[model samples]
Target: MTAQNEVTFRLTRCRRSVPRTRALAHAVLGEWGMSQDVLEVAELVLSELVTNALRVPVPSDRQVGVRIARPLEDGLLRLEVSDAGAGRPEVRAPGDEETGGRGLLLVEALAHRWGVEERAGGIGKTVWVELKAPDIVPEPVGREIAAAMVRPGYRLRARGEWRVVVSVRSEQCDAGYSAVVLGLDEGPALRVQAVEPLVVRQCEDVMSAAIQLEIAP
Candidate 1:
């Protein structure tokens, strides 16, 4: 089996990008059929990671990198946020009157494990977290069918809203596709592709559910 199912995003260093990254992660994880419990925890963890990354004292032109992945062999979801700044994040208990400095505390409490590492061949560091993913069985689908279903015009419903597939990319290392989708009402969303076999299957399952809903009376 492939090592993991993963997606990466690069966002400008701005306040608005926090929620945008969170929403994108939520959509991709939903397509993977993560349990509601896992989703809620993952979202909160991701938000803190991204928010902390933005607070790093990096150059204005530097972009923040976010990666979300799940190992194929285990029940864990991993999130990484990389920035071009050079300090390790410390988790300290916050005072009752303090209005800030609680991000890492929240991360430590919610994640099974998390740490900071030097960014591979990069200028700064990556802060990462792992969370237990329970009760998620990757749906199975043929490669041909998955490729056909994730094309640019494809539509799927997620989180009670319709989203249209805006783009698709073929993975270089494996027979998987990554797609970018936008909510019908929300403009310019992020990628929703699956790079591992298990994730491809789950993407197909999402499409199947959408098709069923579309045809229902």
Candidate 2:
């Protein structure tokens, strides 16, 4: 089933937090099966937001909060950065002589929509942006797992029809066998057991596989 997945980070106010936030965002969004294009844009957005938050002139001990979420139903990726310091972030027009101050401008250009919100209790504000997310892709099926070329986001023939792979899982069974569970684009879940030691290797951006797997009667 498709659901909203989110992760938040509390970072110390410092220059190092900028790169650290980018790395954390890459790992989280990568694990969520985001495409490379999405990953790149999200990392850039996170960098700008986190950098802006760190620049807020709050107390040294106060921390900056960063949140990354993908709401499957909305088909958009949401990014938020909250700072204990006051003032809303504004997009600026930088002249040719200006060396900086164009972060929010880049954000405004790339983000589908963005705005600021007052934090709870009115102690600070949260800057949030949303980007259009790619459609959800289903997981690899049983035959694909057995072939060891499990590619997510690729279509495969199953039950006499083509379906995308949304999620994939493999578990070692007793003896020399493994069990694989795949969630398809539709509501059906594919379960298979392979006796010949399975080695699942992931390949990104591959074409649809013509291999067919039959569902149990």
Candidate 3:
């Protein structure tokens, strides 16, 4: 059975939280079997969030919180940093020569989406960013599209056979490749360099589910 990918850590509000949470993230993400590219970005994003949490003006009794989870189960990795501080974070456009105020800038550029949310207790807030796993590769055949055609339930023809697309997700596949999820088992997922001609159809019966997203700039 595949292990569930989720982790949470509460670190001291001191400066050491920066490196401590980063180490934890490294261990947890490695165990979750993330690729090197995904791991590199995860570490960078984790470090930035932890650094920001440590800088927040929280009381001495409160500790900084960090949560990492594959909430979507569709290749989306979420990294969150929480603090019981009064300040709400916002991205500031720093001048070219400025010394600071560019953390969220990197976050926005690397993450697919990001946002801030009030903690359940209402005294704190969690800053989060979702990073898409590097899996989906755009097939090079007819349409020069960047995304895959996901029609749930119906089997699609590819590589001279028909197979079901159990799930659809956006991934960071390089320019000319197609991401194929063979199945949920220990089988290998293929990133075929090119896709053969096939008829693509929309999933008519599957109603589009509206997800409550909290993406911010």
Candidate 4:
């Protein structure tokens, strides 16, 4: 597979995603014909990365992204977990009998090479790990679809009021389409879109309000 060949999962931020991250990596690596030992280590590495990623302070509706990639002509399997979050990870000395705080330390032990890189647009950073790939031929697969950033923050009527956009990525669907997933202060979030009539109605509201203010006696 080429360097361009990669798969990304946009994840919902929650405790349930810890297992979901492992499952997604297992499925993708299994399809690539990776060995059991390699799969196990990759899963462990990913679990730690995902756990720490969820710790970052991000909005409930914001998503974390995980990407699996193999660079062209490189014998390394790369795993990356990205989020629109703030924080640079650093290994700390865990005291004896310490119950936790050894996430990055485990990454260093398992990964051949690991580091942090600034994500595009400088909105966040990606923590990555590279492992030696077993001598196995990958199954034939096509490249994942490319998506463009549509909005930095899409304001829409969600949760019975207007709120900031959680995510907005424009993807091709025989032509073009986009969707929004918003979070509410309480209860479950909703998925909505701006259709033709909604667009026209909003324009009408804007005009009426602007003209109404001008009609003072």
Candidate 5:
């Protein structure tokens, strides 16, 4: 695993408190100027995992906790919701016209990648989701395209699949800057190479022009 930014929050094992979890997510993402579309998706992922934990029986007075971290360089947002439930979660297949059974489905759809893992200390599970953020301004053109498709900073992959992770964070040196890092798991990683910076500026300009055209008459 690569080192990056990480934050954790605990949630009481109650369905009524799920909104509080969503509120926390909103505040964190808002600090980064994330689009509402991304925040809505993250909230839904939290709701699904937390709801599932509430349905299961937990040992003693244990509660649930949600961890939100974005690795500094990877430009990906990471979410983990953990509970002391005894069993593993299974994704259910939905039938036509079904109104529910879609929470995990939403996770798979909105997240660039997601999974479940046993918590490090003891029993229970952590359901995690990661989303790729647009890299900081002035990113090299080739890296920008690669980051978008490759999942900003994913450092590790599963045993078999070639997975990626990205992390993002704001830092201050002479001035403030946002860093995007990329990670590749279970395979060889690539090194960065230089490209004509002018080409990059042109690409960004083209995208900006296209957006303006869409809004124009």
Candidate 6:
């Protein structure tokens, strides 16, 4: 699909919510049939945005937000994270002793192209990145949707608040599976269950390989 066929989403800014941010990208990319290389770049941009949002200070009335969109000129996936912080981000050289300051550097290297912009709200800035996407789309067939996704046949166990597992029955059908599986921190989560007719036309038209979703407790 062309960039015009792309999708966009926005979310609040919070450091601990990075996993939630990553999950948003995962679900959207999955719908688009994007590639791993593209997803990697997307994740890198997401990381930078999340870090910047967490590090910056916001106005008393404002919160951070993230926007993911695709520009129409080409099939470029763009990621933008905005916050109400006061200053623009400076591209800095990493220092040997410095533990921080390397996130943007990673974004600079991985994204096909990236930049920062002032928010329309006029309160903060949004750092963005754009990259090419893979051409193939998953037929959504031969793939099982579970309460949690794990590399098929593999079980995930946790001592904390997260719980779920996903398996890849067919790598060719479900390529570029996200290795980063996130468990819920609190509250109920949603899980997409495997369904018949992996592919479907719409709510009324059902396919043999469809994956159905259910609410999880």
Give per-residue CA lDDT, model 2, range 1-217, as digits (tens).
2212677879998899999998888887777778899889989998999988888888999999999887646678899999998878888998999998999999999999999999987899999999888653333333333522444555555665556777766666565566666777896877666333332322453326534433222
Better of 1 and 2 by lDDT: 2
Q: Which residue pairs does candidate 3 place in steric collision?
A: 137-177
Candidate number achieving the greatest lDDT relative to the actual structure: 2
**lDDT for each residue of candidate 5 in 1-217, tens digit (9 for 90 to 100):** 2222455778776667688888877777766556777777777887787877777776647888888776656778788888877777767779988977877777787889888899998788888888876531111222233222233333322332334443322222232332223334435543322111111122233443322101111
Q: Candidate 3 lDDT, tens digit per residue, 79-165?
A: 998989887888889999998889888988999999999999988899999999755222222222222433344344444334454
Per-residue lDDT of 73 in model 6: 47
88 Cα displacement, candidate 1 (Å)? 0.4
lDDT tens per residue, model 1, 1-217: 1212688989999899988987988888888788889998988888888888898887899999999887765788889999999979999888999999999999999989999999987689999999988665543323334332455455543343345555544333233334333333355554444422112223344554433111111
Q: Which one wins by lDDT: 5 or 6?
A: 5
- Please report how far candidate 2 places residue 82 from its true position, in Å: 0.4
What's the TM-score of every candidate structure?
Answer: 0.63, 0.62, 0.59, 0.61, 0.57, 0.56
Residue 211, candidate 3: how far off, in angstroms? 42
- Please rank every candidate by TM-score, starting with the best: 1, 2, 4, 3, 5, 6
The residue ranges of model 2 lying beyond 4 angstroms of the native Cα positions read: 1-4, 136-217
Model 2 score (lDDT): 0.74
lDDT of each: 0.70, 0.74, 0.65, 0.67, 0.59, 0.56
> What is the lDDT, from 0 to 100, of the residue 35 in candidate 6?
78
Model 4 clashing residue pairs (backbone): none
lDDT, candidate 1, residue 55? 86
Q: What's the distance in Å from true for residue 128, model 2?
A: 0.4
RMSD of each: 12.4, 10.4, 16.2, 17.2, 16.6, 14.3
Top candidate on TM-score is 1
After superposition of all CA atoms, the RMSD between model 5 and the true structure is 16.6
- Structural RMSD, model 2: 10.4
